[model samples]
Target: MGQKKKEIIKSFLLTLAAIFIMFIILFPVYYIFTVSIKPAATLATTKIELIPRNVTLDAYREVLFGFKGSKISKNFTGTIEGQAKIEDGKLYLTDGKITGAIKYGPFTGLKFEIPVSGIIFDVSTTENFQGTLKGEIEGLFVLTRMNDDGSIGFGIVREVELTSGDVNGVSVSGPMEKYVVIRNTGKAEFTAVGKFLNSVFFGYLKNSLLLATLTVLLSMIFVVPAAYAFSRMQFFSRDHILYFYLMFTQVAGGLGIAGLIALYGMIVKLGLYDKLPVLSFIYAAGSVPFNTWLLKGYIDSISPDFDEAALVDGASYLQIIRYVLLPMALPGIATVAIFAFIGGWTEFILASLLLTEKNQPLSVWIYLLMGGIGRGIDWSYFAAAALLFALPVFVMFMLAQNYIRSGLTVGGLKE
Candidate 1:
């Protein structure tokens, strides 16, 4: 009775710990999705919220359209003391004391006065004019309307700092790049940013797919035979050579940054520098040691009796490997292939170093969006891209989840 009680208590504690760990792991994913839906105003609030007061799917729009922003008509909302009305292609804040076609935000409208050129003009800070917010401080406000006449502006009733790390870029003279997350302004908002992606996003995606597919194919071609040789066949110094390769996988000692740069330069000299297919060879080369290790362990688990049975039936070594060994080791192969594909998908540094603009993959494209020189980072677009980038791998993993579980134990050891 005592032992049974102790076992139950231990199981209960472990279950509780597992649930807690899962919550910790899943919270950041929840937060990312929330940020995608939350308005720009709520972004500035330091308050922690599991559920957003105002949710907008405009970020999804921006990702698809790559537009700077969606055109605002009669529908917009903001949490402020004043109401904004658009008339005759112009916006009028109930008390904002300004007249303009429209500029970005307080989608409804609120009056704001920023100190400018040694004068407190008390004029509305239109999106046309750059208003510097103290960096990293969360502010409460919405980018109202960027009017037809090409004047951009925003409204914030409460004094709040527009954080740099938040979605809104540093207040600059062109367009409103960031907005708040919570808006009480009762209007249909159009705040998506996908318009920018139309130009090169597809090309980048294509390059990435080509690289990943070829890498997987090449890796499998080389890995399977080598792993089978190591697992099933005995040759001179086989263990020694396998150990050397295992050591190489653990550490590539000589290929520091300088060596990598030199290698890239050589590829450039060989006229391979900007080609997407080059990544296949590079990535396949890198994957060999690990893939061989994984597949070897899996192949070892398949009983030698199968190989001998095939031989007794007059099956050649190649035929036995093809018809018998591969089918049995499908889980390990699938796992390695998925890993190789993801590795290609996320190869930013090497892609950037080796490929030029036209041939660069989506990884490099996202990196370039850091908004180059003084324009604050566009966190919304970045997050949106990250979410999109994650979808393929996530879906693939979910689809292959069974393989992951089945192949996780490669050594044929049963506990």
Candidate 2:
């Protein structure tokens, strides 16, 4: 009765721990999407709003289109006798006595006209009226003008210009130039974040897929034969060779392989450096010993009766392996494939050492973002990128969880 109570208590504690772990894992995912959807202005404010008070599409627009601002200056050269009218963000000449009125389009050529006594004046063909009436006024302008004939001008004015006016009232002169300012106004925070995420999400994803597939295929090729040899064939120093391979698993680390690779290069005289296929071979080589042992254990668990039965049916050793043992060891093969895939997928140290900048895996790419190009770390985009990087591995684990569990159980129990 006391043992039963202990077991029940242990199970309850395990359930509670699982729930806590799940919540901890999910918190960041919830936070990222929430921040992505947040408005720029609200993000700038101090108090955090769990639920957005004012949902806005401006953030998305800024990320896609970018923000633009312009500084426009209007220059005038004429005679003014009276005051100017300022209404609705536009300057209009009212009681001004001028010899002529000139209108200049924003970027077009200027137009000049003569006004006589508050009326339109048409002077004779070469008449130069030179009564020096001077005045000046300057201010910012927006595209808010809409004509009665259905023409639209500038939009809303974001900033007002500082103005200076002279006593001449007719002559206005200041630089009339517009300076447009473009800025990125998205929650992405930094451009590198997007690039890094892209590298890991798509770039790393492709490399990892290719590397994993090749690693698994090659590992199985070598592992199956070696396991079969160790299980059935008799050769000199076979036990010693198996012991050496088994001992290889306890080596210091990957750096030790550098010497062997160097020797191989001297003998072969081939440049395999920074190549993906070469890296895949290295990965397969490293994984082969453990995979061989794993397969050997699974094969040993299968009664030799199956192979003998196939042999009596006139099957050769290769045919027995192909037709009988291989099929029965599907679960174990899958387990080996998963191991090789994960190892290659997450293998960073060797990839970083061997691959060049362009050929580097996503893991190496992610590491590059720590402090390259003289730019500091951008956490927001980094977080987003990291989430994207982890997604595929997470998906793989979820998809293979059943097979992995069964394979592990079978291998453990049988061995």
Best by TM-score: 1
TM-score of 1: 0.64
Off by over 4 Å in 2: 1-11, 17-201, 234-240, 252-269, 372-376
- TM-scores for every predicted model: 0.64, 0.55
TM-score of 2: 0.55
lDDT of 2 by residue, 1-415 (tens): 9999999999999999999999789776766545545443322342444674555544433323222222222333433344433323233333443322223333222212222232122211232223332343222223222333322233321122223333333323233224222122101111333223222244555777788789888998898878888876779998788878978665734447776577456534667677788888888988998888887777677778888789899999889878897898877788888889878878887788777776776677667756532234443344445555566778877988877776666766653
Candidate 1, residue 312: the lDDT equals 97
lDDT scores of the candidates, listed in order = 0.62, 0.56
Q: Report the C-alpha lDDT of model 1 over 1-415, residue by residue, as the tens digit.
A: 9999999999999999999999999998877777667655233352456997687866656566442433323222222212333223222233322111222343322222222112121222343322222222223433444334333443332333222211134221111223323223322222222123222455567788888899999999999999999988989999899889979855773567876877788998999888778878988888888888887888888899999999999999889879998899999889889988988888888888888887888888888876552335545556676677778899999999999777767555632
lDDT (Cα) of model 1:
0.62
